[model samples]
Target: MLGYGGTSSPDDPTLEAFKYQKMLADRNVILSSCGIEIESGEKAHLVGHDFSAIFSSTIVFYYPQVALTCTLMSAPHSPPGRKMDLDVMEEITERELGFEFTAYRPFLLRDDSWQLIDAHKESLLQSCRGLTRNGSRTSCLRDA
Candidate 1:
């Protein structure tokens, strides 16, 4: 979520750093859509299942006592700043990574990010589908 949301946008306002205030508004809207009050999730045990971990963790950063605890599934909670916002996956991973990390390519905040997203969409969706399908499919299927 580094290139996806708030995260110190006021100090460094850019389209890539989506506004925190706007994010809060959208969160409330989602809660409203689900018939939940804006404050109903306060002090709740939050769960983050991947990149959305930023959303879960940001709530805690804004309000330290907001969530009782957070369980991050795939991605770790990023530090509460945009200091490393401009670093791409290739540069960062090249330092310590011993192998290729293909999954991160699409989210490098590049102009062609949309194209990469499009390329990975089927695999991503298929991964989600495989999980929801509960063993019905063993892997992401390549489109014929």
Candidate 2:
């Protein structure tokens, strides 16, 4: 599970989809929606995939420092060991450049500054997409 956060705006799945496609090119990470839209007499409702609902809730309580980095959470399916966890993160991170995966110490940005976080995230995503587009098979557990 890879998590992200932004104060710029609420979660926009459509916009996020484009960004995700541009960033996470690994075929494993599949982002989709399973909600409904209802329009009533004088009101409307738009519901989609709530990433928080599925994302690990312990991020805030367990890894507070992650709140500042471009990365919010990264939960990998390894053999229940620190080394395996590092291996998985490294493999996925290798798809993109400039990502130093150190458990929860992702330093994609400086000091939780939201100014460049989105751009950084997009750049990384674009690079990840390029890897797959260039015919390399770097697999993530979340791949489609």
Candidate 3:
């Protein structure tokens, strides 16, 4: 299970205390319902541990055309790293979505390390145009 809680303003001790109290109450309900015994302040610690474990497994997929990003972490063998080179990912997107490929910049590291991948600009553009005309709803609706 995954959970999130936070104190919005750490600078204000009163506000932080109030937020922590609320979190404690909410966590108590969850723990009791789940039949779990957690000591005082342990709810926050458990939540933090669970959150970190889940976040480390997360994968983010970026779609430029729709200006959308999706995070997925449920699957095994997902990439693990701070960043990924998705230059060739545009090709995969084009093929899977039946869209044309357009211009795309390859991923470059700060130290000048580059992944050698051909970016097909024209194909990407065609795919984007097709997607625009059809819209994501109609095109990918069958797959869902």
Candidate 4:
């Protein structure tokens, strides 16, 4: 499953990205407290051959600045790296997107799927109050 964790510092744009990393680590620690198994790996030297594994998958603690647009107005604290690292991360994300798209397909309500809607209408209405407030936003909902 893909999970998204937002940082607590959205109100402070000036906060360093590493703070979010720390929050993720803290969350992992909490999970460990709840008996989840997690790897407590040591930091590898950026300039050494051992650091090559970072290219495989991005550790949550590390957000590559190259993933974002840079300009004269950009923040000055970005890590120094070859342009190649950004390219690697982009490729990885593109590959991951293939699975992400497929995972969402089963959740999508298709035009033909409206047949199931009327049968489930009462339960749907009772559970989804937002649907009443917003009305049916999709063609399937309106058609049903």
Off by over 4 Å in 2: 1-75, 78-105, 119-125, 131-144
Q: How many clashes in each candidate?
A: 0, 9, 10, 0
lDDT of 3 by residue, 1-144 (tens): 322234343445355433434544554577668765454323222312323433323312221122123333422333445453355655675777665332222222222322121255554445445666564433233211
Cα lDDT listed for each candidate: 0.58, 0.36, 0.38, 0.38
Query: Which candidate has the highest TM-score of all?
Result: 1
Worst 10 residues of 2 by lDDT: 37-46
Would you estimate the TM-scores of all the predictions? 0.51, 0.24, 0.23, 0.22
Tell me how far the alpha carbon of residue 107 in candidate 4 is from the true structure, in angstroms, after superposition. 24
The TM-score, computed over Cα atoms with residue i paired to residue i, of candidate 2 is 0.24
Greater TM-score among 1 and 3 belongs to 1
| lDDT (tens digit, per residue) of candidate 2 on 1-144 | 233552234356666643433333321223222221111112112112334322222332333332332222233322212344556766677657434334223443346644554657765465457656442232222211
**What pairs collide in candidate 4?**
none
- Candidate 2 scores a C-alpha RMSD against the true structure in Å of 15.0
Q: Which regions of candidate 4 deviate over 4 angstroms?
A: 1-9, 17-20, 37-56, 60-144
- Candidate 1: what lDDT? 0.58
lDDT of 1 by residue, 1-144 (tens): 333444433445465335666676666666567675647653456677766787778777886665667887877678677554424654465455532334343345467756765788876666656665442233322221
The alpha-carbon deviation from the true structure for residue 59 of candidate 4, after best TM-score superposition, in angstroms, is 2.5
By lDDT: ranked, best first: 1, 3, 4, 2
Model 4, 22-136: lDDT tens digits are: 5446645654686653454322221212222332124322543212221222112333353444445445644764322122223343745446656787765654554544432
